[model samples]
Target: MRVVIVEDNAVLAEGLNLLLASSGFEVAARTADAPSFLAAVAEHRPDVTVVDVRLPPTFSDEGVQAALAARAAVPGLPVLVFSQYVEQVYARDLLADGLGGVGYLLKDRVARVEEFLDAVRRVAAGGTAIDPEVVAQLLVRRTSPLARLTPREREVLELMAQGLDNGDIAARLVVTERAVHKHIGNIFLKLDLAPTDSGHRRVRAVLTYLDA
Candidate 1:
């Protein structure tokens, strides 16, 4: 598949280009800024675009805004979004047009070459590959009951969706496992999940969130 990459970090961008090249895909164009990024799309009209959520000038959500622009410029163009952090708000925006021909994955997933390539292919073929972390993040405040969670709770929720255990989360957050457990309980209760001890709750929650 022909693809374009829009990432501000030169090292990471070059690395991804080589990876995509090695994976038997054509790198039609590469740009680190928004203008050139959009130019490449209009010039090449690639089958899929591998876009970073941040870009030059602001290093914020420029890439995301660019993808939205591309959608307007060329309807049905597939977009695969990669980000250093998982932001559900951005994911929702990208998938706002109904979740087809779009993917939102964590940049770390690029290390798993096969999965990364598969995500590209999936989005190009008109499918969604929202990271489980993103799914959980969106679910944090979606419950019927209102729970005002702190930023730390949101971080814990993001980690939890990655299938991390309480101790593992504690180590990552540099907190006690009890804190993680309390966060999980609050999340489940706020989300109005059925009372269940089975681990399938997360899975079920993810599936429901994605389908929504």
Candidate 2:
């Protein structure tokens, strides 16, 4: 697969490039800043992107913002964020739209080549692979509305929060699509959410769950 590496560290970038190349993946580009990253993506449209959570210039969340922008530019583009730290707030924003073709793994994970490569392959294959630590952080919110839900309902809600469609949720729960929709409706009611046509039900549900 063709890949782009967005890391500010020169040595690390070179190492990753060499490693991926040896692993039979094409390295499209290695960039530092947000603009250069976007440009490389536009040009190469790599099958996957390995991005650092912090990048050059400010080294804050520029890489995260760039990843978000890349998603907008190329819907369904696979992205794997490599970071040393796990920030629940950042995790919320990263998975805000829904969890498809995305991965957030600690940089230390790279030492485990088998698992790290598996994560990259999974993301490229249109799968969700969130780090356990990140998942724990996301589960901490436990929105008050979620308390009203039964165990089954919460199971469905968690899948929904992960951006799974009714069909996906049903398959996961071994139920019918109708049942999944029913669970969603119940979630909305329990959360006291007024249905709106705004195109952000997932975002609303997550925000409400976190607030609660």
Candidate 3:
């Protein structure tokens, strides 16, 4: 897949470029700052764009704004955020339009090459791969509907928000698939989420609402 990277840190940008190259992905472009990043994406339209949460000028929410604008210019362009902090509000804003092909992941997760690639691939395939930490932060708000979930239910929902299926979450938690299903059912009830086309999409909508 062709990839575009938007990270201000020179060292991290080089490292990410090398990582993507070694993984057999074409590095279409590498840039920092909002204008350049958006321009690169508009010019190359890479299969996926890996962006950091902060960039030049402010180093606060420039990356987030760029990502949003890039997507606005090219709807469903498959953007994956690589950030150290979990800004739940930004996550919600990114998904405000309910557009798929998006991912919000922690920068620390890059150490796990396979997992990072999985998230990238998932986003490219029009799936959500939200960070569990992002979900945790969203759940912390008192107004979060997830506040009604039990501890186990919350754990299951957290994994689900990461785009994991019942089987995957079951294996991760070392529990039976049936137990995972049961927890999912309870989760739907607690969150007042109605069933959708399939498992992951429904859970993704719930997670989106939590972030919203």
**lDDT of prediction 1:** 0.76
> For every model in order, what is the number of clashing pairs?
0, 0, 0
Superposed Cα deviation of residue 13, candidate 2 (Å) = 1.1
Output the number of the lDDT-best candidate.
Answer: 3
lDDT of 3: 0.79
Candidates in order have lDDT scores of 0.76, 0.77, 0.79
Task: For candidate 3, write residues 1-212 as lDDT tens digits.
Answer: 98999998999999989988998899999997889998999899888989897677756567877888888898888889888855445657885567768888887755688899899889888888888777666667437766666888888877877778889999999999999988887765444343443445465545654685
Task: Candidate 3: list runs displaced more than 4 Å.
Answer: 109-111, 141-212
Better of 2 and 3 by lDDT: 3
**Candidate with maximal TM-score:** 1
How far residue 155's Cα lies from its native spot in candidate 1, in Å, is: 15
How does candidate 2 score on lDDT? 0.77
TM-score of each predicted structure versus truth: 0.65, 0.63, 0.64
* Model 3 residue pairs with clashes: none
Q: lDDT of model 1 at residue 67?
A: 89
Please rank every candidate by TM-score, starting with the best: 1, 3, 2
lDDT of 1 by residue, 36-80 (tens): 989999999999998987676655467888988888898888998
Error of 2 at 45 (Å): 0.7
RMSD of each: 11.2, 14.6, 13.9
